[model samples]
Target: MLKALRCNSLERCFQRVTSLAEARQALAEPQTILWLDLFNPSQEELQDVGAAFHLHPLAVEDASHKHQRPKIEEYDSFYLLVFYTVQAEPSPERLRVCELSIFLGERYLITVHSEPIPELEETEQRWTRNVRQLEGGVIVLLYSLLDTIVDQYFPVLDAMVEQAEALEDRLFSGELRQRSFTQDLLALKKRFLTLRRIAGPERDVLNVLTNRDNPLFNEHALLYFRDVYDHIMRVADTVDLYRDQLSSTMDANLSIVSNDLNKTMRTLTAASIVLVVDALLAGIWGMNFEYMPELHWTYGYALALTVMAVISLLLLLIFRRLR
Candidate 1:
């Protein structure tokens, strides 16, 4: 679906266009700033928009294709930026990343994404309610979009932090089964890695927009971009910290499991020794000798049993002392 919002220079007029053709018509107003958003557009639709705007074919291709890394590229007429929108799924083991491509020009901004972005909807509503917000021009629009995308990282990070804490509690409390804990830890690690992959480069992208000289962004707009960049840095740092925590947690879990196994083995070994001693005495007595002297004694059977019991008790006490 294609959605368009246009505001005039005075910020007094605002309109929403439903089709790409109507958006193109709105763009004809030189003093108007337009934001065109494409949600899961078909290849042909993307190509048509590209052709209409005279966008670089490479940029169009990147937008059409999925899984482009977060980046910013400068073209003669516009700037192309790719970013990932991240959200943690209901399951702690899962994460969702959606790619968003932006083409920012002097008077217009276009965004393309394969998934519905709640931030985009919020931004659209803000502009719809008050057109004056768009008076800062396309740069302000770009900043809003970036800020929204960066803001989303916090919730995902928060979810990860909660999961990490829960896992730690379970690990120390001995509530988590070893096998399941390992699986969960590994899964959380993967989620953190995925978040890092998205946030790390996206931070660099924002840095370029903020620190580097880009004709598309004026000095006033650069400050806003810097704010977004700072947020991204925070997210990146949190991801790194979480990764370290996960590693440490995994190590602690392994140590606990190893200690438990050692205790189990020790108990088994002690039991085996006692059983072996009992079996040795039984084996000797079972060897029936025709002239055994003890066999003739009236108390011989009682004496043999008492001796076996005493030996077993002594061995158990010795093992316990050693332990």
Candidate 2:
């Protein structure tokens, strides 16, 4: 389906079921400034649309596949933007990710995705309910979409921050090691790495502002793009910080466990030595039961007990000194 939303009016302004003929006609719009979305199209349909827009064959191929890394490609006439969306992880899972590809040109923007993401609907709703409240230009509208994606990055970061603090606390307090928590931290780090791969390419797409010759954003829109750039910067910084925190937390967890294990081993070593000495004494007495010298002594039992107690006390003191 092809849906066109006029930025100025902020309504589902003109949604046409675009056929090959209609798409060819759409290119002829004289003064329409609109956002067009095409979702879950078949391969033939993608090819038809691609042919209509003269898209890079490679870009169309990537769009048809299920797993294209998030990226941005600047073609002669428009920009091809590959981005991701998050869906609630089903049943027991925590989250699911989907990709979105956008073709942005001077007069209209085209979005393509395999799934109908709620974020797009939400974007549309915002455009519809609060149309006039928005800044009207294409870059501003683009910013809104980028802004939504970037903003979603925050909650992910925030959740990781909370997990980091929790892990830090557990490490300090010498609690049982949390292998799963470390795994979660690592998983989050990996996910953020994927995000980096996607967002990094976008820097090239949005880098238009720094160079005034680019047509994406005008002088008046540079600051808005700059603001979005700052947001992207913060997210990049946060990804790095969280990765560092995860590594540190894992190290701390390992250190705490090793310390606990070493302490346990030391105590067990002291006990083992003491047990050996006691066993030797008992064995000697037991074997020479035919009137052994120490066994025949009147106070032998008491003396043996006293000797064992002193040895135990001295061993404990030596261990304490070493510690």
Candidate 3:
């Protein structure tokens, strides 16, 4: 899908351009700010756009591929930026990451992504409501897009924090078993690591945009990028803290499981000792020998039974006291 937003002197227009030819025509207009957004464009479409804008072949290739790390690369005529948009799945244990590639030029901006980003749609809505805000040229639009993407990280981080807290509560209350809770903690740990992998590099990307000298961004526009840099730093710090907390939680869970197992083994050992005493007495009495005089006595059977019962009771009392 291809969507375009054009802002001219008279009015602002937003439409979906169906063919590559239409997108090229929109870009041809003079003194207009055009935003072309392509969702999962084919190689042919990418090459056509690259040819039209004189974009470097290497940058076009990078845009066509996935799994690119977040960074900013400066070219002779434009800047190629890669950023990740994050979303938490219905299951809090997992996170979904989507790569958004942006080409920022003096008069035009192009965004390419395989997955749908709600942040882009929201930014378009904001642009429609007030076109004047984006009149500052492509830099303003670039800032708006980056700001929206950075803001999205907070809600995902918040959800993960809530999940960690809930798991901690269950751990202490003994509502979750060791095996089940350990699996959950492991899942949370993995998600946190994934988040850090994205956020850490992206923060550095923003830091470069803020500190480095780039002709694409003016003094006023650099300020906005710095603000975004601060937000990314906060997100990075929070992720680090959560990782430490998760490690501690896992260690505590393992300790609890070990302690429970030890108690069970102790109880089983005490029970086995009591049974062994009874078995020993039975073995002695059952031995058949003609020289055994007690076998002929009248009260011999009752006396033997009484003796066994007394010994068993005494052993039971001793075991209980030791426990």
Clashes of each: 0, 0, 0
The segments of candidate 1 whose C-alpha lies over 4 angstroms from its true place after superposition are 128-133, 174-178, 288-295
Name the better of 2 and 3 by TM-score. 3
> Tens digit of lDDT per residue, candidate 1, span 186-279?
9989999999999888988988888877666778878888899889999999999989999999989888888888999999999999889889
Q: What count of clashes does model 1 give?
A: 0
In the range 1-323, model 3's lDDT, one tens digit per residue, is 77777766345555555666676686677757778898999999899889988899999999999999998898989989999999988776678889999998878889999988899988777666666655567777888888989899999999889989988898899674657788888998899999999989999899888887767677888998999999999999999998999999888888888888888998888778767877787787778887875667888778877887898789888878987
TM-score for each predicted model, relative to the true structure: 0.93, 0.81, 0.88
* Candidate achieving higher lDDT, 1 or 3: 1
lDDT scores in order: 0.86, 0.68, 0.85
How far out, in Å, is residue 104 in model 3?
1.8
- Best-performing candidate as measured by TM-score: 1
Which pairs of residues have clashing backbones in candidate 2? none
lDDT tens digits, residues 43-111, model 2?
Answer: 887887788777888888878887776666677887777777653344321446778887777766678
lDDT of 1 at 273: 91
